[model samples]
Target: MGASIPPPPPVITRSSDMDPHTLEQLRAVKEMLTAQEEEAQGLRDLNRDLRERLEDCETKIKKLNEQNDEYAEKEKVLSHRVAEKVRNNKQMSVVMEEYERTIS
Candidate 1:
């Protein structure tokens, strides 16, 4: 949140002695109000920009997570294929040994 605005200056009465300084005081107060308003607006703009960046980051994370899941599934399929190949090789080795025994 931005800085809180100060309470407005006390209302000036039309007494003769205080009359001279009233206009000066009014001008000073007006300038202060303007400055505060500008600061608050700048903070609002910064907040909005940060929110947009966070949303972009979240979207990117979602895409990467989905890609990772696909890779994991592919790895499972390849592992099964390798296991099957190893079993087939063992069976062939046993058969070759039996054939040599018969020939000898």
Candidate 2:
């Protein structure tokens, strides 16, 4: 195999050697980056607020769901009791009819 050629040394340019136009472009890029950082911080704050609100909403939803379950159970119990009362009333009416017929 042929020996690998070494890479050329990187040409180093000092900040003082940078042309005025290149320096201006660099300064513009730095300003843009600073603005982006500020915008990112604002987004982070907004995200934190939204997260807190979402958590609160979730908690409220959970509480409401639990309350709904409790109410459903209570309704079921009430419905069962009402049905039992209706059946008892029907039986009592049948008994009364039989008694009246015997009396006649």
Candidate 3:
């Protein structure tokens, strides 16, 4: 004849065996988890705001760079004009000196 398998042990319940300290610790853990969830949500909102601000700053910087290029082009044109004026003035001074010497 084959041997039979043993049965599993039965569970025992006792309402009087509950520990008060363990219950209090469980409640404290739940409160901590709730607080952590709220803090995480706040951080997410702040990160989104910062990302939007960074995009705005990037757009402003691009516009300023375009304006700076326009100003640089204008400056180059003015510089060329000033150089021509200086050349003309030097030539006129030499001509005046020659005239004075001839007249003396």
Candidate 4:
């Protein structure tokens, strides 16, 4: 195999050697990165707030659901009582009708 070529000497360049356009591009990139970081932070804050609100909403929903369940149970009990009263009333009416017939 042929001998490997010797590595070239390191070239030392000053920061001033960078073109103005390249420097400007670097500055723009930095600014963009900073803006993105700020935006990300704001989004994180908003997300936290939304999460808190969501939790509050969920808690309220749970409480309401529990209340609804209690109301439903009460309604069932009331309906049963109402049905019993209707049956009693029907029975009383039948007795009254028979009594009226006998009297007439």
Candidate 5:
């Protein structure tokens, strides 16, 4: 934890002050606290990893959107070119028809 839990109240200075059962209880409490600390650390690590992945995904999505925009622009340009070609072909056909009529 950010602020360590003080270290478990130090070992009993003398055996006379506390009974065996109390000492056992203290040891069990210490073990439980240690387990909780380890679990908390694991959760923190997992959170950090997930944040990194999310950032990576956001970057990829940005790049894909840029590519899609580029494709749309290219499609627009190509469509305009096709329309121009159709108009030009029609004008050519009209000119050829006039020439044929005059010759006949």
Candidate 6:
């Protein structure tokens, strides 16, 4: 087999050697990247704020649900008491009617 050839030397290029158009393109690319980074940072901040608001809303909803449950239980108890009073009133009316009949 033939001997392997040595690799070519590395081409070192200085910034001064780079053409003006190429340098302008690089600067434009850098500016675009900076703008994109700023936009991304703003989005991240907005996302954090939205997350905080969502957490607050969820907490409020949980508290409201608990309060609703307590109110429902109180309403049920009150309804039962009202029903008991109605039954007692009906019984008293029946006894009063019997007494009136006996007097008549």
Q: Quick one: best lDDT, which candidate?
A: 2
Compose the digit string of candidate 5's lDDT tens values, residues 32-78.
Answer: 99999999999999999999999999999999999999999999999
Tell how far residue 51 is off in model 4, in angstroms: 0.5
Residue-by-residue lDDT tens digits, candidate 2, 1-104: 99999999766578787789989999999999999999999999999999999999999999999999999999999999999999999999999999999999
Q: Candidate 2, after superposition: displacement of residue 27 in Å?
A: 2.4
Tell me the TM-score of each prediction against the true structure.
Answer: 0.63, 0.72, 0.69, 0.80, 0.69, 0.81
**Candidate 1 ranges with C-alpha deviation above 4 Å:** 1-31
Candidate 2 vs. truth: CA RMSD? 4.2
Q: State the C-alpha lDDT per candidate.
A: 0.89, 0.96, 0.90, 0.95, 0.94, 0.96
| 12-99: candidate 1 lDDT, tens digit per residue | 5764546657768877889999999999999899999999999999999999999999999999999999999999999999999999
Which lDDT tens digits does candidate 3 get at residues 1-104?
88998898653365345478866876799899999999999999999999999999999999999999999999999999999999999999999999999999
**Model 6 alpha-carbon drift over 4 Å, by segment:** 1-15
Q: lDDT ranking from best to worst?
A: 2, 6, 4, 5, 3, 1
Is 2 or 6 the stronger prediction by TM-score? 6
Whole-structure CA lDDT of model 3 = 0.90
Task: State residue 75's C-alpha deviation in candidate 5, in Å.
Answer: 1.3
Q: Tell me, by TM-score, which candidate is best.
A: 6
User: How far is each candidate from the true structure, as Cα RMSD in Å?
Assistant: 9.4, 4.2, 5.9, 3.7, 8.4, 3.4
Which ten-residue region of model 6 has the weakest summed lDDT? 9-18
For model 3 the local lDDT of residue 85 reads 95
Residue range 1-104, candidate 4, lDDT tens digits: 99999999766476577788877997899999999999999999999999999999999999999999999999999999999999999999999999999999
What does candidate 6's lDDT look like per residue over 2-38, in tens digits?
9999999766487687789988998999999999999
